[model samples]
Target: MRAVRLSVVTATAAVAALTAVTGCTEKSSSGSGDRVVEVTATDDKCEVSKKEFPAGHVELAIENKGSKVTEVYVLFPDDRIVTERENIGPGTKQRVTAEVKAGDYQIACKPGMKGDGIRQNVKATGGTVAKRDPRLDKAVASYRAYVQAQADETLPLAETFAAAVKAGDLEAAKKAYAPSRIGWERTEPVAESFGDIDPKVDVRADGLEDGQEFTGWHRLEKALWQDKKIGAAEKTLADQLIADLKDWQKRVGKAEITPTSMANGAKELLDEVATGKVTGEEERYSHTDLVDFKANVEGAEKSYALLKPVAKENDAALVTELDQQFAALNTLLDKYRADKTSYDFTSYDKVGEADRKELSDGVNALAEPLSKLAAAVVAK
Candidate 1:
């Protein structure tokens, strides 16, 4: 469910920043004296206030002056994302906080949220980031284990779904589909960090790149449900799907996991629910969005629960809000399922407009507080 609108350049080219300056001139500091890099994103250019800063927590104060919704990325020289803030609407402002090691990096702004973004070379210089709370380190370790476990579990379920597809048993494939996706949906942010993997394994038809072959779950999904025919091409895709998943499973342990990334990733899951599952764009044919939706919430909750000890110590009120909102959202979701413990739920197509609105509202309410989690967890 990644909206990978941009094609990444090669490692060397991705490190080179475009030389264009039409925005903020000098660097500034927040009232708390943290390094603040002001980013002005236009339709054709991405301007950063300063190209260098001390390594630790840096805040990107971004304003999208473009005519379209934009996305900003803090990327490794190899185009691996460190952290990102997506869907920044025209004329709106957003602030993203990220931790960085001392190294060369690029800040990319994707205007219209497509193609390789305008890039700027930036450097995180020498500075001692404060010693983190030991619990935060433990939280990261626990989350990493959770991510790998999800990846490990998902492959077998996906294999089951693929086996059914290869056999041309539509009913069996349909039965396996929702169960197969639960693990992936739960850890999508970690999975998506691989850059090359998500598009191959999960990309929807509309999210496809130019001339990109449709060969992921959605492609096979269309074959099973929409096209209502499983042929040679679909059989091939089913095998390819398992192959891609295996690649993801092998690479899962190497993903970058940090406290802020986990917090940011938790929020990203809600964004997924809001834009894809809730809108019925994801699982459009199968109407199994509720299953995916539940998984996203569970994933977010897992991260929050791990971080709660630190977050509560830092900002008790925010934790209170998160607890309430999570409970409320989970309760709301329960109404759709007759068997509360199972994945089975009323098909999304059977849900009414009013019910969808309530769901959307629940997500938005939780997302607002959830977005503050990174800052809270990192607070002294």
Candidate 2:
């Protein structure tokens, strides 16, 4: 559902909330440590009570002292976020506990959730903490459950969407299009296990080989929105989409989802949004890029959540960072949330370039930390 790795320059350019220097509700999977550090955040500063520690399981309490919204993060030497907390409005608070090795680290704060905030160094004097999370297996199991739920949800929606299209009811089909796609987007890694089915249904115009017939969603999307009509061929395609989705549901039900692949799937889904949705390519005719954008985020979020407990066991700071980043990104996407389920956004064609750039930047910021999720969760 995502992938990202932000360089120092890239982090500065996109800003938003990220990195370490905050605290929160969740406890590290590893037992509590003797170390407790308090960090306070101002609009322009991240102040830590201590800069050096023995670094086993360290407790961090990050409070927003700024008048505006703020976020905190722990960053690696490479400037990647190790942990973070977001949207501490006014005087809210967050906390985290993490295990670490003896090394140089940085704490970055984003005030107003804009740009990279101030970064301060943190030192760990002890050797690396060992990885031994009992929850690791449960994490993978939970992710499988989430995928299964999405798959089951998609079955009926797929039928409804395809049925409307086959009936030449463009309006009904358009209405059904988004929800049906949500299940597929969320369960993509599994659904894609079907060699020919995924490409047949999900492949975009860019993936279309010469003389290869354009089929699937985009193909039908054109018929409904651009042409504003559906013909016999279009109806036939709708039926095939249904069959493909059904087969996908059946096959994916028997598949295994590992921690790394699930994490990778989440990252890939975000890539779909960054490259296609942000650029206004997906659902071009309807300008419903945001719809897919939101769905992709849901998929990625569930994946990260599944791996979170184990990640916390190894690198609580990273778990915190991911939680905050995901929240910030979801909040960003929620701006488009019109009702309980849908977005209020118009097509990208109607959105200004600056706004589009902002969206792209935000996506990149989240992607950076998200890319690290798999490795963090699966480490032994």
TM-score of each: 0.95, 0.63
lDDT of 1 by residue, 37-86 (tens): 88888887787778888898888889998898888988887777788888
Highest-TM-score candidate: 1
| Candidate 2 lDDT trough over 10 residues, lowest sum | 1-10
RMSD to native, candidate 2? 13.8
- In candidate 2 the C-alpha lDDT for residue 11 amounts to 38
Model 2 misplaced regions, further than 4 Å? 1-134, 340-345
Find the 10 residues in a row with the least total lDDT in model 1. Answer: 20-29
Q: In model 2, how large is the Cα lDDT of residue 154?
A: 86
